[model samples]
Target chain A: MMPVEAFLRQDAEAVRPAPALVKRGWRKLLFGDVASSLLTVLISLCALWAVPRVLDWAVFDAVWRGNGQACFDAGACWAFLGAKWPLILFGIYPPDQQWRPIVVVLAFLAITLWSLPERNWTRATATGWLVVIVSSLLLMGGDTLGLQPVPTGDWGGLPITILLTVLSLTIGFPFGILLALGRRSEDRMMRWLSVGFIEIVRGLPLLTMLFIAAILLPLMLPDGVTFDNLSRALVALTFYSAAYLAEVIRGGLQSLPKGQEEAARALGLGRLATLRFIILPQAIHAVIPPLTNTVVVVVKNTSLVLVVGLFDLLSAGRSALTDPDWPSPYIETYILVGFVYFVICFGISRYSLWLEHKLSAGVQR
Target chain B: MARPSPARESTASASTGWRIAQVAIVLSLVGLFAWLASNTAQNLHSRGIMVGFDFLWRGARFPIAESLLPYDPTDSFGWAFVVGLGNTLYITLLVIVLSTALGVVVGVARRSSHPFASGLSAVFVDTCRNMPIVVQLLFWYAVVAFGLPDTDHASHPLPGVWFTDRGLYFPRLHLDGPLLPGVFVLVVGLGWAWTVRRRDQRRRTETGRSPHAGRKIVAGTLVAAVLVAATTGLRPSLEYATLGRFNYMGGVTLTPEFVAILVGLTVYSTAFAAEIIRGGLDAVPRGQWEAARAIGLSEHQTLRLIVLPQAMRLIIPPMTSQYINIMKNSTLALVVGYPELNFITATTINQTGQALEGVGILMAIFLAISLGASWLMNLYNQKLGLVTR
Candidate 1:
């Protein structure tokens, strides 16, 4: 074969026209591709015009202290939020006892951040979560360690939201797994019962369930017996979360092949042992993305407790608006609360995406 | 085989024991439910609370801000519920149409070659989807109620439409003359167009060549309809809103609550819908796109005839769930005082102290709506499903 350089040298000598003055580099970035470049410029112009006005109102011109009297019409009244932040964060909890909820919230954030990395998700981490959860509940519930008892009704704001979500998921997770198992069981009655429960709960809105928990559950109780509002709401949340979690788990269960179960059985493994040692570990691992999505949903749904008159983060924000002392800064309060919710939900979503990437990569390997 | 033969008696006993256990479990559950029911009855009796739904026939004296059906303060609770159901359905249907349109536009934009368009869509989807929906609803309500001009100086962005803190008012159409004849003509023209298209398709299939009759049929239909309207002297006019001392008159008005809930639900649901649509579009294999291009089809033609049909199959199932979600989320309208089914039921429960009956009605209505939506979507899905030998 002829040397490749000989062929190239002949072509190179034939003619290298001056390289055309192509629009490369910055010109290409801005205007080389007419349609897209024009659109990008247009959008950038709009953003440039809009962002400064928003930043001016939200920060530079905002009122940062003392009753918002100095705030201009065009600016945010951050001072209103500064005054009401405690009320919004702790609801009507006693001023001295507010430190407890602060600690509880910190503990929740710490545990959540600790659990974010997959390598940290060991049995010890699970135990740590349990410890944190119980201690947080105790801290909020009080009545121990020389602390005054704070009734559940007195609990409010971010702590309540986090506690409701975490507690319900803790209770709902195992129950959901059982429901999923029952839904896929060989026994006809078990399957039908599971399906019925799941559908009935799934069909109704969480608001109506909360109403039943608040008003009707007590009515059903015997005379002179009562259920606390928080407990009832917790029960409702558990059942509601379980229905959705069951569906997610069932999706994972369905994706598993029958041979896995058969192999376990052929090895003389019993049903429970096969599920615990073989089937569940793989199925749960397969479903981490969806499970995390459900967790995000539960976090959002915790706001529905507001409908039942519980003082969740949303309800606290609304309550903050009712103070005659600082009435006009509703937007500022809403923005702050919304930011808090956005942070948590957005974090969970990002984590779920990362987990999905990791899991799919593992599958390829 | 020999081992099995030796355990016949033991096997019979074991089977009987299993049956006994199942029976015991079932009976115990039944007993527990019966006890709960009797306990509820006793509690009601002791508390002197009515257990029946007859209170539904009594008058509901509360005024609803928005209703699709005729409603009065003296209307029966049952009638009030019907009106609430009407409002819920109206908002739900409107939101579904608007969100689907917005979602398609944004979803397509998300895949645009332009970096900015895709980024803009991504920000919209993320911001709307991650925020708590109640906060969005409240934000919209606050903006509408507090941001808009006062009633005395209402903004008239258009000649006949007015926006005030109270609501938005727009001209309603009134067919003043010969409406029936014009509609009849229009229907007939549409039917004729359908037949023409069918015949053209048949001819193309049989002979492998046919004229494109679509434009001609559409033009013919328009001409016929216009001629009929002209001959019949059909005139449609807008009935403009007039400022009354206390409120607007003559034209339709949408209350701030209604506007807030409608816009909130539409915007929020559109975010999820856009993501679903983008996923569906992405799921269509790139090979399909290349093949369509190889056949010398234009980009628009490729999308319309090849890509979208396949994407729809992937989109419809998730889109159906999103539709159900929008319907369920409509209950949030209660927060803004839109007098939807949930609000009405909550009021009835509070007024009558019939929480059981009121919640039961709410559950039944929602279940029926969800099931109906699911059934319709399933039928449509079956139509789109792959057919195989």
Candidate 2:
């Protein structure tokens, strides 16, 4: 037998060669094979070429403060953003009432965050969302609340985008579920009708749908009945969102074993009761992640309203660039708008992943 | 045969009440559509707008600014629609090819064991995908329109390639002499070469021997085509761009709008396509790779002959959806003022006051394309999928 000290020393030597292991890992990552070695060099060279140029443009040589004239040879015209951010965000809302849109934006954020936790996702949260949305719209449509009335035309920029996305989704969710159910229903007529509606809408691009809303809806409506561009666009988005979301929900519904419905029926629940209590809850939860992805898509697609002459966030940015006083800081303005879109969409996507993890723990797909 | 989803039919026959409810729902839906149709008629009649295809025959007085086909301002609206359609298809095809290539690269890189490759691809996908494509299109448009140097200070990025804010100009190729006869001969030669390739593959699979005449045939076909072109005086000539009075002339120009839309769509679509491809690749069992290597196959051979075929089945379904998305998203070209189908439709509606007809036509054409493409893809999917039990 080896001495106790000798054995202990051997064990210690073998336990954790942390630095050596890490060194080998780095070597493999960089130069494990000829292809990897070459790729490592190529990546480094590309980074060397691009990173500093980007850094200089975005930071080092950027103008932090000044008007258009100081931006003549600047790498980035950040000051242009400072001067134009109000217009970019409020889009011709009364200068004094700009805080209203800000509140609307905050209300949207508060409801969204409050409803994020799994335990918090109850009917009360949905009611909270409804209250928030109604209050926000009333705040904006201020004729009744003794505040200055802001016309829908003046309802431009980020609030429009956020509101459109949230409204379409909320209105479309139940309709989407109904469509999904109809498509899978035992009634042949119901199934085919649902299929036809979904396919027709899904077949058309959002741009074409917007064209219908903006141009054709007036012609299609009664002579005296007219809806503004915002209402028309909301209608189009709701229809489009319902179709897209239905397909995603259908996927979740299909994942369930038939025994679920059969078991619910065996438990003596009625059809509607089974769907509401047993089927829909599980099915909707199963697809919440994908539903959020579709929501992100809608958030992006709201920018298409710009094509319809609606003053969405993208349109606001474009209108801001029309100021001749500014030294045509087109790139800088676009970067700011794109960054805002990125933040909204990326936040939703991250939350989706987190929810997926939370909801799917120990559950095999 | 396609797999029918287990729809979980209602366990018992519906009660009379349920049947009545469904019938009522259907009838109400029909009545609603009928009401809308009559409402539309009344509105159109009151507005005194002509609602028919008759406007299509009239000259489209507006300028299209850009078209793939030769077009005049005096062209009929019907012809204008055709031109717009040609432009849409051209961009759609070009973007599809480019995005597939780029998406595949980024996707493969995402799975790379090399840390830099995977990390870089991850950043690229995240950034490009998170930003909306419309913003990306407008951003790219700005970059193309204002970021590039003007013609007077154009950048020569490569030989025969000029980049300017006005457009990108490249040396144009002109084939002299009878192009039809030379092209006919080349087509025949290529067809023969394709047959040879098929035979080679057939023989290889059957007898474990590839009598590789396919390559020789391909080479011979190409040489013969070149020789024919030379003999027929159909030699290709390059026309270099020269600085004209105001801008560069005499070479092909890709306008700022076209370039912006193309680049934007390709980059945005690539991110989604890359994610789909990555998922498909990840779905392929690791055991397959190890087994291929255990049988002494090289890494390249294992990928080409073993891994990709398995991964392809998983990839194609989602890829079809991605391709369809690309086609639909191509309409975002409207944002950059590219004269695509939606752009033409809007313009036609504006000029003719035929919004209903124009939108109807647009939706119908899009519907046909979407349905037709999905049908073809489903057929192809069945071929690649498991055989019927």
Candidate 3:
């Protein structure tokens, strides 16, 4: 099948011709790829030229030493953020006990990363989570752990934000599953109640729920029973997260075939046993991606803490902009906040996608 | 008949266990409910707060910015709620229009042959969708709004449109006569097209020739529209907006809240819609298109006749949910202060101090809207479903 020109062309393509200007053979192909690479490099350079300018403004031309007047330059006044960093992070927590928060934050991060790996999905993992929860409570809500008492209001910044997100999900996921199951129940009354609950919760905006939690939840309680503002926020977050999570779980449950449940039932499995052992595993596997997506959404929605006057990352960023010394750094502060949000969200998204592919790989027909 | 007694005995034992389980479940549920109710009552008693609807009729001292109805601060909380409902409807309608239009266009463009168009579609999807809605909203509010010149230095670069920090101001259309008549004519035209389509289908079945039903209906509708327009003498003209020292006049102005919400929703949702449409189109076999052309059908006819009808069946469920999402995500309007249900609920909560009542009303409104949409779509879905054994 080989023609004379094909043979000659193959030989020519393997080695370069003598004349550099002509750019024959491998040289021509190599040159094309090189040209594209060079073009890409040039584009990246142009795009990233602002980075050095930002760096120069942030560090080199920055006022690192100033408190107020010395930051009066055209560059970024990171010194303002520097001064208020602790206040922004820990809010009005007493100055002497700042290390408690820093320690707790480190512990929280360590435990979170430890629990994130799939290999840790065991009963021991649940136990570890409980320990972490107790430790974090003692660390943050300190009077009982031989540490100075720090009020919930004193909690602020990224720690509270993470706490709200993690705690909401921790409680919400189980209750959400129960709600989802109730919604899918054969008993008409139970189904209706669950449906009513989910629909009612889902229909209202989270802000209204937060408003209710802040204003009326206390009023709805017994005379002596008072919930702290942080607890109120937590309750509001749980309710909102649960409603959405219920929907996500419902999606998973619906994806499983009727035959799956039927098969389990035929094998002498009770409804609970079928659901627990067979149906839920397969259904939840199918929905890991969207479930993870819901988590990511929860993370972003944690920014809504600002509505209720909590000092989340976004609120902290806003507060940073308010400092009289560095009013012009609003853009820079917001950009930094946005970058942090994007990194976390994007990481979760990538993980979700990878999980989706892995789970669905052999099942592809 | 004789063997049934042992089977019944065995089944009765199983049924007994089921009864016990049901009893336990109900007992637990009732117990939880009682506990919650008692706790709530106790809390209410303790805080000196009465949870009732009595406050609903009380005068709300707060004023809404952009209510469709006449609402004064002296109005009752219930009256304020009506204003809030109207605003919610208005914003929902506007967002629905913009999002659906943008979604359809982007959905189509995602399947475009042109590399540039496809690339642009991908970029739009990736950028708008990958970014969180809150971040996008904040970006629009902070960067875009602040980057624009102040209202004092607002410009009218276009003939009848003004751009400012407040919002986009465009010329409002003023009709010489009642516009409802025009709408009636449009509805009548649709009816006429339906009748013509039925007749054309009959003709095609009888004659064994392909029906030119689409063309026939379109022509008939156009003729009916023009005839009705002429009869009604409904000539409409634009009244150009005039920018004065303080405010713009003679035009409908859009607030930045509406703009930001609309822009965010449209771009963010269009990406998902694009994926849905692309998936639907790709699901259609190439053989169908080839066979369509083999019958002397043009490219447009092949798409319209052979492709889309099949694709629509696959598209409707997802598309229906997307539409529902548009209604739900309209709540995002609250963040930008677009006077939607959530915003009004916030105001109501602030004004009447009836958190439960305000939230209850909001949930009811959303549920009504959602249920109404699903009911309508369910009917259409049933009709369009494949009738197979």
Interface RMSD, in order shown = 2.3, 1.6, 5.6
TM-score of chain B of each: 0.90, 0.90, 0.84
The CAPRI class of candidate 2 is medium
For model 2, the superposed segments whose C-alpha errors exceed 4 Å read A1-24, A362-365, B1-13, B177-196, B206-211, B220-234
For model 1, the superposed segments whose C-alpha errors exceed 4 Å read A1-61, A71-74, B1-21, B207-210, B379-383
Residue B312 lDDT in candidate 3 = 81
Q: List the residue pairs that clash in candidate 3.
A: A221-B42, A221-B43, A222-B42, A222-B43, A223-B46
Clashing pairs in 1: none
Q: Can you list each candidate's DockQ?
A: 0.51, 0.62, 0.21
lDDT of 3 at B149: 52
Q: Which number leads on TM-score?
A: 2
- Tens digits of lDDT, candidate 2, B80-119: 8998888888888898899999999999999998999999
* lDDT by residue for model 3 (B274-360), tens: 778778888899999999999899989998989988888888888887777767666666766777667777877765556666767
Locate the minimum summed-lDDT window of 10 residues in model 2 chain A: A9-18
- Go through the candidates in order and give the clash count of each: 0, 0, 5
Candidate 1 local lDDT, A1-365, one digit each (tens): 88788756544356668988864565555565777677777888999998997898788877787664575464788888878889898898888999999999999899889998889989999999999999988888788866899988888999999989999999999989989998997667778989988988888888778877887777776777887777888999999999999999999999999999989988999867999999999999999999999988898888888888889998988888886665467677778888899999998999999999998998996
Greater DockQ among 2 and 3 belongs to 2
The model with the greater TM-score, 1 or 3, is 1
Backbone-clash count (model 3)? 5
